[model samples]
Target: MNEYLTSLDRPIEAVRYAGLTVKLLSTGDGTEVIHHTLQEGSRWSMQPQEGWTASESIFITSGSLKVTVDEETKVLSTGDVVSASPIKQGLVFLALEETEFIYISSQPVFQFFSEIVRKNQELAIEVALKDGYTAEHCKRIMQMSMLIGERMELSPGDMCTLNYASYLHDVGKIMIPKSILLKEGPLSEEEWEEMKRHCTYGKELLEATDSPYMRASGTIVEQHHERFDGKGYPNGLQRDEISPLAYIVSVVDAFDAMTTDRPYRKAMSVENAIEELNENAGTMFHPEVVKIFIDLIPEWSKMKQGV
Candidate 1:
């Protein structure tokens, strides 16, 4: 019997290039499923490569597209499907409008996608070494963020975004001077301003990478510091203007910060942290996220004690 798999169960390998968004849905056993979305007027060309011998079946799931195989051109609409054999000349695709389609092929063309994942992991390690405190903090934030996401029943895609955002949220600190980042005392106004630039810096760094994980989580990095009452850094976006993933990270980040020792102060007790979360709920953090986090901590503590 054959197995069934949803898109969520498979890792999404996506590339955004030349007005096209190509996602490799699955790559296994010499077969690959690709989802492609092309913007209007965008053209994509594929030339035959030496030693590449795989046929492709293209299905137009939405909008319209123009496909040219060799010298043959065909316009296809929704529900239309076409197949191209392995030829020496290859093919080209043009989106008549905003179009979406699935391309199933028998070749392994997704090695670049795996490379992106590997690069992200290496960057995370570099960031972690730059600040040991942030390294531990990120781990706790990741755990707490995932727990809250599960309680809220976020979709797999959302959870994936949240996970990456939580881990890399402070990656911008790498750009900050060690003097400001590891200062033993409170920052001067100028130093504080420089410190706050981490949010924007993080977003800019991630956006510049153009990696799929970075693209998905860049906004979260930018807006995680924003408060519900509209008084935060980088941007003053408030309330619903912030992404839900940002709100989730904000709550967990704050909780972990409070419960961990800092250069200037001792770690607050869990009870004290809970009180602070409650008091600042709906102002500094999302009220609902704060509530869920506060409720979840006791369970987390019990587990830590192996009770």
Candidate 2:
């Protein structure tokens, strides 16, 4: 890796192989380091000295794992490291819950990881379209949120998370009943409660895949509905408790929704939407992000018009 760019700058992408989530970190000298996410039901196994010859090692970062090495079984938790070794019985690794670890290998699988990320993205977009979001809407939100991200000077990893979170934010709508989603009037309290489940649903859907950006974005998706003052839903996380990416997405999400036509009402003028954003600053939305977004409204409008 270049001294100028850390591994986080290596493009936020990850791949799922045989149900295991893997993020290819860096590669050189035929050796590579990758991050792995092992869900509870998922297990990883290596055949006894199977063909590929590079030695492998694992360092568990979080969650618990059951490992069977050379007929010996042990349960390992966070901060545990399994050194590189070859055993005749091969290896069996099962996650007791959603687990994260770093794996180093003397082999390269970049091309393979890259391809799975691509396919996962393609499928995510398709899933979004099926749930009633127009392609243009998703694009505008992504562009606007990224603009806010840029203004905030978020790190490369954070900016990527913001972009993807905005794109997939509404995916949870898929689980809502079409009657409720397409209703021409405001939702009743009961319906509103059900509708809000989209945030939780969105997180679940995104977490099911290996795409690094998508999985990372899931946190923002679930928190975008939350308010800075602690009145948001799914979970009442407030103040700095929310992800900054979620805050940026929340502000941009509101701006776009207000200024665009919806089944429930006609679009609010840009001035009104701007006013709404200002009115809620420091309470409903983060004041800083709202200011940054409002400051860039003209530029945002140009992007919206272009879209």
List all candidate RMSDs to the true structure.
Answer: 14.5, 15.2
lDDT per residue as tens, model 1, 1-307: 1335674565564665435677777777868787888887555444444455677677888989876544467888999987756645534556889999888878655554335444444445554433344444565676577678769976555665676677678777767887887666578999999999989887887776523445567889999899999998778999999988899999888777677665456778999989999999999999999889888997656533535
User: Worst lDDT window (10 residues) for model 1?
Assistant: 127-136
Cand. 2 Cα-lDDT: 0.72
Compute each candidate's TM-score over C-alphas. 0.58, 0.58
Off by more than 4 A, model 1: 1-132, 302-307
Query: What is candidate 1's CA lDDT for residue 136?
Result: 45
Candidate 2 TM-score over all chains jointly:
0.58
Clashes, model 2: 0
- Which lDDT tens digits does candidate 2 get at residues 169-199? 8778777787777666678999999999999
Worst 10 residues of 2 by lDDT: 43-52
Candidate with the greatest lDDT versus the true structure:
2
Model 2 misplaced stretches (Cα beyond 4 Å): 1-133
